[model samples]
Target: MINISRRIQVNAQSEANGVSLNRSQVWEGLVSKARNAVPYVSAITECNIVEDQGDRFIREVVLHGERLQELVILSTEQQVEFVRLSGNARGIIKNVIEEENGELYLRFSFDFSLPGVPAGSEKELEFATGMQNSYLDAVRSTLQTIRNKVSQ
Candidate 1:
């Protein structure tokens, strides 16, 4: 099993206040947005809202792939109460977290199973690469949509 992790600081200064919507608030709206965006979720079968605990929430999302077929993910809203998500294409991805002063952070991590023999099958690598790019693009599009809505 090989894992890939990416952590970025969206805003290093005043990121806390920079996110027009609070973490929990984002989670609230995210559910609907995700539902509407399901078709674009790559391998997502469904995103079922499970729990909302004031500061955090949980969801069960099913991801599909040729090799794994389907992967059920349990995502949670973590620190800062930001949204967390998982799926087949990219595995698990966590959104913004740990707001301090005015700074905000975002992290996305994924776990990919490398087929043993032939040193990680070539097909697995191709899927991983495609999914990784798709995940990043999806996040960017989602954020841009949010920003546009807020600006209006």
Candidate 2:
């Protein structure tokens, strides 16, 4: 089992340009990404909301040429959690909106494992590192996408 986690401050760059996202706007963007991640995640080539139940839904996405199903739970403007139901990756990924000193921040975290990979082995470490980098880019892209939408 391998575990990777990280968080990036969403408004860090926006603060310099005088363009910032509030909690609600960020939350809306999160939900939109959850419904159809192809726009936010570069690796996700296809996305479809298979099931919808208000704040909770099931989505199917093709990520890196692999098909995956995820149960998405939305906690209003606070957080969005994606639990992988089927795929090589098995775990929970969360997009959370937080506030510190009245400044908004977005946090992305994930816990997952490859079925046959030995924990703590070099292979696992290498994979984790790549995944971490990919996820960091995804976070930055998500924020940028939201910023673009807000500006439009």
Candidate 3:
């Protein structure tokens, strides 16, 4: 079995505060946002309180598109971390976060690997790449929803 993980980091500078969002808070917002997003995330998805034990999380989403069945699992267990996806996705950093002369920035990371992938196999790369692209899009949509809900 191949180990996969990915994450999106955002140096969110809220108009009211510039502190990093508490990890648990961020995860909560993510799960809430995803739950309401539908199809891309929808109500049927599974997100857990502890994904890997020790300040980590697990978000599993089942989506249909790209002419294939897709399953995405993202594990954020490290500080300088990334959300990892597996099965058909390589994992990706979808957004970039940074402070440019006192401005907010976000950096997203994505990565993944397929089980039983033969060495030097292009098919494996395809699976990982395709999933990364699709999942990144999902994350972006989900984040936007979160932001909107929070501001309201």
**Top of the candidates by lDDT:** 2
Instruction: Provide the overall lDDT of each model, using Cα atoms, as 2-decimal numbers.
Output: 0.48, 0.86, 0.44
- Candidate 2, residues 1-152, lDDT tens digits: the string is 65666666778864325568888888889999998899999999999999999899999999999999999999999999999999986888888888888777788888888778877889878878888888888988888898889988
* All candidates in order of lDDT, best leading: 2, 1, 3
Decoy 1 TM-score against native: 0.52
lDDT of 3 by residue, 17-73 (tens): 333443444455554443233633443344433244433344454345321222223
**Per-model RMSD to reference:** 6.3, 1.5, 7.4
- Residue 86, model 1: lDDT of 37
Q: Report the Cα lDDT for residue 131, model 1.
A: 57
